[model samples]
Target: MPGLAGTERKNIAPGLAVSIVLKQDQRTGKLTEGVVKDILTKSPHHPHGIKVRLETGEVGRVKEIHDEE
Candidate 1:
């Protein structure tokens, strides 16, 4: 929890635990927690956050990467 989660592409990877904001939830700033199944963002950085697919088959933009717990 000490380290920061960057929107840069290098900061996210498959199998990492992360919190993402789904398209519908963006207005409310909702966060969904799940293990990353894939990185959907093609760019090196995104202002809104990197898009990704979770293990649960949900796709969204990563808001924060969860530290090992």
Candidate 2:
């Protein structure tokens, strides 16, 4: 718990439950379930998208966000 001192984070504003699709192969349409671990934003010149870290340790980008139920 060395880094736990300042690791406390508050709830994200406008946050809601969301389900992301994890596609292993978009060509074949193969996909799996994913859990959003963190949301990362890119620089202004680095394109535009939200990076999501799945519970399965898979990291990818999503063009848009969706609400689930």
C-alpha positional error of residue 21 in candidate 1 after TM-score superposition, expressed in Å: 0.3
- Full-model lDDT for every candidate: 0.89, 0.39
> Root-mean-square deviation of each candidate, in angstroms?
1.5, 11.3
Q: State the local distance difference test value for candidate 2.
A: 0.39
Q: What's each prediction's TM-score?
A: 0.91, 0.39
Q: What digit string (tens of lDDT, one per residue) describes model 1 on residues 1-69? A: 346564889989899989999999999999999999989999999989999999999999988888886
- Report lDDT (Cα) of residue 55, candidate 2: 59
For each of the candidates, give the backbone clash count: 0, 0
How many collisions between residues are there in candidate 2? 0
Itemize residue pairs with steric clashes in candidate 2: none
- The superposed Cα distance between candidate 2 and the true structure at residue 13, in angstroms, equals 8.0
